[model samples]
Target: MSKPPATILASVKQTASVIFLHGLGDVGASWLEAFNTYRIPKAVPHVKFIFPNAPIQRVTLNMGMPMPTWFDIHGLDQNAKEDQPGIEKSSKYLSDLIEEEIKGGISPERIMVGGFSMGGAVAIHAALTSPHTLGGVLALSTWLPLSTTFPKALISGDKKVNLPILQCHGDQDSMVQVQWARLTEQGIKAMGFKQYTFKEYRNMEHSSCNEEMEDVSKFIVQNLPKVD
Candidate 1:
């Protein structure tokens, strides 16, 4: 499959790039509003933002109804069986996006991958399996899918990812329970993933908040490559 068309916010010089994936049911264009709503363009003017749309697919948890999802969610249980094939496919697509950015002149270390909810799950998977160490990864309001196999996958990779990771979740997230996010943190840490930060927002739910956006902006600024 070809790379999905993206909604891009180009920087003046395009020194760095962020490939952000939207959650299920969302189109890439919707994140343009998010960028403006959060004033991300103003905060990080040197970095480009790329939001890619997921291919429409049937989700089992959604009663097999079709939706734009990176992978199918069979069940919401913590240990529910994951859609490994779907995740791998999406991860490869994400890697292709990263490679494209690299080809466009951004260094692999200057590119970050991130997403929300289901998108975040794929972002984590891509980052873990990528041969090149990236700027970082942002997993927001997301849990670790295929948790049992992720550690082995990381170990089998050609290089270990030492980049910083910023994981944020809502304390009141009913869709992806905060407990599951904590478990994901524990799982990654057990695999010796250093430089991971887990931030919890009070009174928030299964969505992004102003405070979270502010923190994300800070993370972007911190991790972006410094122009010499």
Candidate 2:
């Protein structure tokens, strides 16, 4: 029997309001450093950060090595499109976790979801597809997933969700390519979707930079559910 692909590591802090999804081949625990430094103590100080691990699965590209992945990489070989099953399944798992958080007293308006790499892509999908609007969605070095629409198209009749999204990508990213990010932003805007902010870093690779994290921290602080 195969193990489930996703697991949520709730923070010791009961007041956590932020959740993080780690990328392919990485575990959720790996992001603790950034969350503690950039996201936790500074931005959403009282917010608890939930780090959810993607499921371990046989990746088509990595010689079928079972690694943490939200979706298959086969489509990545075909111009970075996403596989529907993997994307949808992963989004459901993440959404379920978010709902549990809500039950624990964190309102949708007070919760923020973000991720890195494939995890970032999953974050984007979950945020848009979720029934409730969120405080914000932070996508780092990621792209839109399969079966997704932008601002207005994503909203149904009276289903308006004015979600502020933050997109950051590395200009020197060889894996995902900077152009993908640019094209995604353009496509969303062209479709009449707004309320998104994008930042592109020069000479950066597939990983997050301190400056980028710093900028993200500030954005969270400024946009998060304000305290009384």
Candidate 3:
């Protein structure tokens, strides 16, 4: 079993949940700390927060240096070889987290899954493949992996195909370049996904900015509001 995720319990009656995943070489604690630094928790005290860590493994992009990675990356190129199996494995873990929430009494519709960069890539995959329809998907500084296999690999009749997706990226990101995000935008459009929002930050790099964080907080609230 994986390590228990860092969590923030809701202040009021819990009705919704958000799971935020970190990027390569990151741990759930760091992400949770950063999240606490913001007003996200206060913004929605009724929403439970979860930060899960990816497993540590060798990364080819970093010359095989071991790091906490959701999946292996052969390279950063848009067309580089992707670790499909690894991605699927990580996606299952995320889905299992969602299952945990559902089993704990939170409805599937009240749950949101999200992540940054590589983690965001897996979020997109897992959200698209889940048998249940979630509240939304939050993908930051990331591109769609296995882009070609999409729409086909996506579940045939799952409501996740129409799942709300908020994809944010830095226009000046040299790592997961803005071009890659644009391609993902085009792909999402081709797939006819409803409720998809793509936000590009000006003068931003691979990292996030205050404006992006503000948008993220709003997205969470918008997707997972208080239930009656």
Q: Model 1 misses residue 89 by how many Å?
A: 0.5
Superposed Cα RMSD, model 3? 1.3
Off by over 4 Å in 2: 1-16, 75-81, 147-161
Worst 10 residues of 1 by lDDT: 154-163
Query: Candidate 3, residue 46: CA error in Å?
Result: 1.1
- Which wins on lDDT, candidate 2 or candidate 3? 3
Sort every candidate by TM-score, greatest first.
3, 1, 2
lDDT of prediction 2:
0.74
TM-scores, in order shown? 0.94, 0.86, 0.96
Model 3, 73-189: lDDT tens digits are 998886689999999899999999999999999998899999999989988888888888889999999988888888887874346556889999998999898999999999887
Candidate whose TM-score is highest: 3
Instruction: Please list all clashing residue pairs in model 3, or write none if there are none.
Output: none
Clashes of each: 0, 6, 0
What would the per-residue lDDT of candidate 1 be over residues 1-228, giving only the tens digit for each residue? 424656555556778999999998888778767877888877777788888889989999999999888988888777677899999999999999999989999998899999999999999989888878899999999977778786777743444547689999999999999999999999878877777899999999999899999999889989994585
Stretches of candidate 3 off by over 4 Å are: 156-158
